[model samples]
Target: MLKVNKLNKSFGENKVLNDISFELKSGEIGVLLGKSGTGKTTILRCINGLEEFDRGEITVDDISIKNVKDINKIRNKTGMVFQNFNLFPHMSVLENIIQAPISVAKISKEEAVNTAKKLLKLVDLEDKINSYPFELSGGQKQRVAIARACALTPKVLCFDEPTSALDAESIKKVINIINELKNKKIAILIITHDIGFANEIGDKIINI
Candidate 1:
């Protein structure tokens, strides 16, 4: 579960997020819909501890982001899929998926590989295990990114403009992947301007 209360964020004189408040519960998909520069991604960043908020509170599964001594603990529980697939250009798809689990989750390489393979299958990227980011299509790369995020077994997953870089068909694939994730009971937060995509998957839509 994720909750944001009266969340306010600003950069110098510019106020990005204004009293934004919402809650996302397990097995539910929450959508943040607004035009560009409305701080949808900022809300995700603050929740992930990637950006510090000036005011308000964020908690993931009841753990306060502000009070957490080890931010990595919060990050481990919250997985973020960036607008651009932030895959390692040099790493293979399999490698990318396994990296976080082995390094951050302290799982064995053999175990991580096994889990990564399963996740790849879930995202329909098992066939491209050895492929690099450059060799993959936009859809394949996004699937890999999703696989990488799911590898951590996060309680909540945040996707920032997931369909922004894809074609119509690719967008469908990504949406299907997201739809599948709902059955896993993980809270999902999607930040996007794509109303059709949001309506298709969102259990609750929060307009910013």
Candidate 2:
């Protein structure tokens, strides 16, 4: 689903990503494993068009990232989950989940709420939709964040240190959701330091 050709990026005198090249097929879960500061997150950012690379090309399902005329396109097709949940604090759980789809995706509020409720159920957060982010636990918030991402129904998902800040139980819950995504044949790219989680969900591991 993605073809990255001769990707290279540098900053001043430092080169973060050096001639990095790879291809990810549809429905494949690819993992990038490396210690901190090895450019794993940078690679993810570049692929998402949040960071600009000096050279190379990224094509997703035949659409080049360069061809993107706006940020909304990149976001709609490629969803990202961060280590920190990045939830909108001012909004309620349901609003957080429905805002992007209703605003950016231009869907109706009723439709987005309907979709959000279904996603909350999928992530086992049906009862928590009425709560605020501060009212939920870290794990619950992350699960809600995942549900928010799924609200967009992207073709591919990118996770950056998804479970790094979670507790053991929370990690397990998040990983389970990720594994379910793998089973459902959603293209996923995970950047993690956890060896076991990498082994469990990654169909291919690229060490940076």
Candidate 3:
């Protein structure tokens, strides 16, 4: 469902990604691993159209993105979760998820709420619907973030060190949630420092 060829990205003088090439079919669990400064996160941002590349091509489901015109189209097929939860503190959990669908997905408010609730249940957070992001623990907040991402129901789920800030218990819980998503046939790409989890959960690992 995703193809990245000769992808090169640099930040002025620093080169992060060097001719990276990879292909992901539907339902595949792929992992990208490297040192702290490598282009792992940048690669994900590029795929989701958050970071523009210096060169190379990225295709999601045969749709090529080389200009601003295809940015939204490519992003609609991809959901990215950052190391930081990046949740809006002022918004409630349900509001965080529902807003995206109603505004970006263009679904009706009622429809978006219904879908958001179902997603919360998938992440086992149905009871915390009315909770604000600050009201939840790191793991709970991360799960809410995951639920929000899944609410998009994108073709691919890209996670960047999702459990980095969580405790041991929280990390395990997050891993379990990701495993479940993998089983449910969501294409998963994780850029993480958790090598053990990568070995256990990833179908393929690319170490830069």
Candidate 4:
């Protein structure tokens, strides 16, 4: 459902992504694996419209990212889970998950809350519905972030260094949650340096 061809990016004189190319089909998990400076996260940012690439093409379900006017359209089809779980610290878990659905999807508050509850259950955080970010552990926060991403019902989900801050057990839980997403037919792209974790969840790995 997503394709990147001849992708290139730079910061001033420094080139970060060089001729990177890959494709991710529905229900498939793609991993961008490399060292810290390999531009893995840059690729995700480019796909998500958070960064402008100097050259190449990225299409999500045939909608081109190059069309600036349709950036929101592209984003609606793609969900991103950041390296740092970017949850609103003051909002409860349920609120965090429902915000995008209500604001972006234009769903009613009651419906969004119902969807959020289901997502929370999926992430094993149903009991944390009223919990704040500060009250949760790193893994719980990440799971909340995942639920928030899924709230948009995106076709493609991009995770940036998902397991970077988790312990072994927590990493396992996160990986399991990611694995379950494949059944939902969401194309998953994970950018990480953790080879073991990547091998466990990635159907295909793009080395930058």
Using all chains and alpha carbons, the TM-scores for the candidates as numbered come to 0.95, 0.92, 0.95, 0.96
lDDT of 2 by residue, 1-208 (tens): 7677778888778999887888787778899998888898888888776777887777777777543244444557777787788899999999999999988899999999999998888788999988999999888988988888788887778898887778988887887888777666667888989898889878899888
Decreasing lDDT order of the candidates: 4, 1, 3, 2
Scored against the true structure, residue 205 in model 3 reaches a CA lDDT of 92
The TM-score, computed over Cα atoms with residue i paired to residue i, of candidate 2 is 0.92
Q: Model 3 — TM-score against the truth?
A: 0.95
Worst 10 residues of 4 by lDDT: 64-73
Off by over 4 Å in 3: none
**Residue pairs with backbone atoms closer than 3 Å in model 2 (clashes):** none
Question: Model 1 segments beyond 4 Å from truth?
Answer: 67-70
Error of 4 at 147 (Å): 0.4
Query: Cα-based RMSD of the predictions, in order?
Result: 1.4, 1.8, 1.4, 1.2
Error of 4 at 24 (Å): 0.6
Task: Write candidate 4's Cα lDDT for 187-208 as tens digits.
Answer: 9999988888888899998888
Assess each prediction's global lDDT (C-alpha) against the native: 0.87, 0.82, 0.85, 0.89
TM-score of candidate 1 against the unseen true structure: 0.95
